[model samples]
Target chain A: MSRHRTTRQRGSSANMLMTASASAGDDHSDSAQDPLPSWNEGATKQAIIDFVADVTREDSPHFEPRDRRIAVFDNDGTLWVEQPMYAQMDFALEELRKVLPLHPEWRDRQPFKAAIEADFETLLKEGARNLQILVGALYAGTTPDQFDRLAAEWLAAAVHPRFERRYTELVYQPMREVMAYFRANGFKTFIVTGGGAEFVRAFAEQTYDAPPEEVIGSGIITRFESRDGRADLYRFADVDFVDEGPGKPVGIESHIGRRPIAAFGNSDGDLEMLEYTTGASGRRLGLIVRHTDAAREYAYDKGSPVGHLERALEGASSNGWIIADMRRDWRVIFPFDGA
Target chain B: MSRHRTTRQRGSSANMLMTASASAGDDHSDSAQDPLPSWNEGATKQAIIDFVADVTREDSPHFEPRDRRIAVFDNDGTLWVEQPMYAQMDFALEELRKVLPLHPEWRDRQPFKAAIEADFETLLKEGARNLQILVGALYAGTTPDQFDRLAAEWLAAAVHPRFERRYTELVYQPMREVMAYFRANGFKTFIVTGGGAEFVRAFAEQTYDAPPEEVIGSGIITRFESRDGRADLYRFADVDFVDEGPGKPVGIESHIGRRPIAAFGNSDGDLEMLEYTTGASGRRLGLIVRHTDAAREYAYDKGSPVGHLERALEGASSNGWIIADMRRDWRVIFPFDGA
Candidate 1:
């Protein structure tokens, strides 16, 4: 059996010693004294503090190097707005419109038919499998370079319908700050979600400063070949791997090789990742963003349609996962607001 | 098509640089450096000098942050001896003896039968395919933690048959210096090879200062499960990906994202990786270790049973690859001899 380090006291803040000082321009500088400045003093804030303190203090014996401090996050609700439908679904619908003339048969296909006809409710009913079909049709049979260029173009112009902001700007400001904070502290941050890895990787570096290599999401199969005396990696129509539920930890192990010291999620889909992280040997932290503010954001957990949060909420307390009360814990929801 | 950078001209004192540098180290260091240090003043040294200088110069137009300058290396012939047979083959042979009692049927199997009878010639005739079976038998069905421990034990004690020294000690000292130099310059170095990723990863950190996350190699199938209420990654008998040739570029793209500005290799297997690196639209360098010395290091290429060099040699001149002439370049070959 792998050696398991003893867990530290649950709420102890004594072990929070700073390792490398944050460089200038750190997002946390505005509220460095509080450590959890942007977060309200609550269960979520306390859990973060306790975990960080334990892992950072060398004297406490839980200290790990900055390199080993990997932290993975789910994108949709945890990082940005997921309500009204996934942003990628919107892009897929638009793409289908543009490509329909070339592939007239797609107009009659089940999911593609729903997508091309703008029957989003029907598309939603078709669920994840339909989404996979849409992604495979849109992304496959192109070189990775070509796919990247296409994704970048889509992200540049695609605006959220409800927010009327570029999809890039729709990212949650608090989560963005959290990412920056983790990075500044030497944590190798990664985005592991059910979203298409290639799609997210195209703009992730520009939007989050997390490079494509660090993003582990659902992936399509790729083949290598030389075309015109140059090597190209071409995406195939088949799904190679999916990053959801049990697949989350599998993806992490396969790609990153290290168990994350911390994990952040918003729904039950991420519960497995949280379980894996918190159940790891050393100091561990798991945070669940509870969307509880209807005025600023959609507020529903067990009843939410987009990112259903049932098991995650029910097990948060017992599993020592911090369920962030979105209405209270977050001072700001999106970057545009001056909270 | 991907942009390709022109190969930089070698420094005027390229030959002097390697020779002079070789004499500066201890006896073992000199021995290691002598094999390749005095190489004829040519494109190889120039590539090394130009790339190093550009990366080191803060004022250089092509300068990158030291931290972003990552370099990956293949282990076997690139770092140490791969003659007689691959190093892992030696380990497998020893493991066969240990596991023979448990698998009595091996005595009747063709390749295993020969292996049990100490018929090394028959094992060689069965060739690469036979080795694969041996590797799977020796490495499969163990927990990652268990494999790590076993690998560590073998690495610590296993010695090269001809050299009669620990396999770890056979690593070229000049390469060791390169690793340190890269680290000192703030580059995060990694090992990406066709060899078993986990096997190399188990000892790379202790021997090369490359942490587990930084090491990327051919991966085995792994499963994530709760064992005794603790999560662990279990190694399975299946191969996940073979990180060789074109797979090198794919692996790097998937794992590191950014193209490495510099790359080093010893054989044709690394040609695709070097091509990928030098093809990036920036200052880049590619160096190949040509085993030209039969007296000191048993040098043979093309028809050689180990690490053949056919297409790589043909492409070296046109592709602007620096071929390290082992016989002329270095004053010594191993770390044990004085410069």
Candidate 2:
């Protein structure tokens, strides 16, 4: 149902971040033939390619059937930029700005007033509860279809603060290539985000090439109503499920009904998902997209309230998770960036 | 995870139910190639074929893309047998019999007492609550993985009383062919059931060719715990969501995240799913499997407590839903039945 077309043209930009290392063993000189051209040849990149090869090789003991090759990726920091502020937060605040005129009562309300005034301090203090309120207000009265349209429209227009590119264009090219690579190899790629499922579903198909059904995330309860022989679903304010931290594994189990063979995530929120994925009795891969390029992208880790990366960062070595340092591993950040 | 092998043979059976009529418009003469050979020549079969062709044919006004060609089937009655007793209920009772000795309190408990005594009269009066109790007792301390194994073990051994065959073999051959037909046409088939999700997921892939992720149903909350560096999920007695009647649409919306183009159901419990599927603006199809074959299978409609089929049966004509009368539409009942 989410059929939004992306506004940006890929393969036209000439903004390469880093060049491929000549010393690397893999043949990635032929950009047209490279499944992951955006990735610079490195240990991280080789590890990913090797894992895929091992799992897919029919003769290998690590070989997994096509049905069992399920790979889950966290959306926010893993697939796209979540800094400057979470993209969903920016969307919510923008929505609050638009609706503030109608809801005069919100002018005096704590979270609403703080959000309207661009009071980051207060909003951060309130944390997820503030986001929930804003989400409820943003989605009020609109059906999922209508909300999807609004999200798509906003995404088409909204630009990243630093990059000044459309939010959709800011999606990580390497991650996108990884998704496509997995998909090509008969692996089902799913976006297991901590963001709103409906919000991410809006442009997931267009941006990530993952279908709406494959994007599992936090969701609000939707009530089904039939009026005048027309079936409509209404979104409620109550949180149905929160897919973060420990909830990630729960959400994965509920939605996927099986442990993923591989998981790509960024923060501690994804630690459990990584654990669940790699803990299964099979050859599995778990990778963390560590934000370590401040010149190209904001680099914040354990100290950042948005995507805290302490626990998972600490456990990466012990768990054998491939930590992809953006500056070292990725040749290009966004799809708009050139090789 | 659910790698259960069915204990049955494909080509050895010689039992034939009824021969196909010579009046079918489509060529089904090549028995080896007919997509739905077990289906008799009828309006219901024709309608189903026509809808699928219309939706899949390129340049057709009704054509839907491969991704949008999602078809949902109700599990209990629509896909397989649930007449003499709901299969999940039978499994639960069998489990109750196994665990009844451990809990002496159940010996005096109303629902448990009635279940232990094989008091169908009292159990029927108790209704869903009894099943919930039985389910809770059955899955007490077992993790989802453990429960899946238990279910697979039970299904392999369980037999349908009337058919005197494995419950898996008693699956309607016509419906199986229809599922295969839909799948062949690039439609993603899903089992949307009121039965326990875990129970259905155990054999869905093997029996229906529907993966565990494709089977959405009633569920209990699963608690996530990390013990001795191993992640485990324990199923609780708490009801998370019920995928029955009104809840079917909700489950579909939550899991599938889009309206299915086609829906197949057998009872009034699927009324909402049918309405939700057809009410959407699209070329949609809704079909109800009416149990009118007393000679081949059990025949009970409105008065039947197991799968009451009154409201849906009455509304089928007005809703433009196809009613596949089991006795008339189906040439063969079970998979063991011949042409």
Candidate 3:
């Protein structure tokens, strides 16, 4: 936290796309025929449509080259549901319960015990590092196959407490459409998240249509070995890189070698990514998805534990970032709602 | 090196694709009309053809889903000529002369003096670390724009010492065809190189048709900052990640998330990547390029300073890795040499 605490709440995603007179430009010519049907006809929705139209139009001066039309999205809160705690965190807790029999001593361990009892207050008091260590210990040293099987199986079976739906279906319809829209317009969409890289990648391809290669996120160290006439790549418990805040841009540059033209995020964790993305030379969009729907989805800002949107929310206005008010701007919050 | 050091003096690229009897199959009828026309027909050539065919055919048990079709290639000796020193080394030398005026004291330094004097023996003696420090110093702290300008300018003007042609034109024709061949068969081609990523990406798109996003290689730390209402990403003089040997697999997992279906390289540095890629379940191809063509390219093995092909070559036989004999296997070398 101390390594990057300078700009607490001063930057976010931008919106201003160039218009092109190219013959094939904007087939859905007006906001009336907007592709983002899940979004209400508002400034936020308009900004998105305009940005996409401008970038894809060949004649636009601000148009990014097709290969450079990189759109990066934050996974947890921005793309899908991150409420009732992050899905990965939930997965971790569930794993803790399942693995408790194997680790009887974990009942006395601080973070492990806190996790077992679902003591949110104790877990928070114990802090991020302890939680990370516990999670890492739980998931580490497994071959890709073994980890994948466990995660995939858990994901298939696990249902959201409130929605009573499989977590995979928890994805936001608007975001899904946005991804499809970007792909149709030749933009390479990537998920740059603070969550586990492998965790996001496991089901992102099937859900978001963004493949494994396009995902950039936090990861642990991995080792390669040979066994039984086969090579094995397995995960270890050490943090390889943390793809959050300022680290977001670093990860983006390292993996993609190009700054994204568009970035979507919802917390202070995403502030630097928003700044890095929108701060590009020209016509960049930085979007902040403000969770404002308490009825349909949990809405908490400033300091609610999961996805604290304090600094970034305050910063969004200053940067002209589109604060997508979920309550007001989105027509449908979830896929099951059938807008 | 201890992390990954085994096998020597054997293993390189393969060829010979399968017949299109599977449901979702390659349209290319046979190896006689092979897409890799630049490669001389042999088991090595046939093996590559067969692997692509097998993995792409829907009915084949080994068939990879289209999204899982990732093919990684090493840059230096594998895709282009690394002999007479690496092309990047040539770039570094040229940069050294241009920057020598600023660092007159550098003449007293071992690696700097070696670089300034164009003394290959002394430079090699000073070893990789000192040389890396010199090169990192030469390129570091410059904004991505300035560095890009410098690299692109140098690439445009500089000519290969032996070939009297731009270094970009020195890419191997057979390798280029293989990239195209895999791409045609729905495999996404990526460069997983130990060379400087930016240097390769600056010209790779034009020369190899592998865009900046598709190019993965070693990189240094880069910082994103803002001044005069503009953002700049400047490279620092620190090694962020070296995509060499063991580090190659780490980079691939971090960036691409999924194991590549096929891996190609020419040096010991690529051993880990080769193992990581081909070691994955089901059908996988690991190809090594042996620089045995002295007439068209420089011939070196076991102890070449540029790309030492030692342990990897020795271990290839047991691993069933294909050894691409440049002299015997490649009918044509450089693309400029003609069809």
What does fnat come to for each candidate? 0.21, 0.30, 0.36
For residues B141-240, what per-residue lDDT tens digits would candidate 2 score against the true structure? 6788888888888899988887878777778878877776775576777899988888888887677656678889888788778767677777877768
Best by lDDT: 2
Deviation from native of the Cα of residue B329 in model 3, angstroms: 1.8
- What's each prediction's clash count? 18, 0, 30
TM-score of chain A, cand. 3: 0.85
Per-candidate DockQ values are 0.21, 0.24, 0.24
Give the Å shift of residue B222 in candidate 2. Answer: 1.0
Interface RMSD of each: 13.5, 14.5, 17.6
lDDT of 1 by residue, B78-167 (tens): 777788767777887889899889989888996778767767567655334455556666677677668877877888888888888887
**C-alpha-based local distance difference test score of model 2:** 0.77
* TM-scores, all models, native as reference: 0.82, 0.88, 0.86
Tens-digit lDDT string for candidate 1 (A1-339): 111121111111111111123221242323455554456677667767666666666676888765568899999899888887788787777777788899888878878888877676677563345666787877777877788788888888888887898887777766766776665455668899788887888777666666566788887777666778777676777767667777788778767767788999998889889988888677788899988899988887776556878988898888888778889998767666643
Per-residue lDDT of B264 in model 1: 77
- What is the C-alpha lDDT profile of model 2 across A85-153, one tens digit per residue? 888899998877787788899988878888888776687563355666678767876778888888888
CAPRI classification of candidate 3? acceptable
Question: For candidate 3, lDDT tens digit of each residue in B173-212?
Answer: 7887787678667677789877778878788767776667
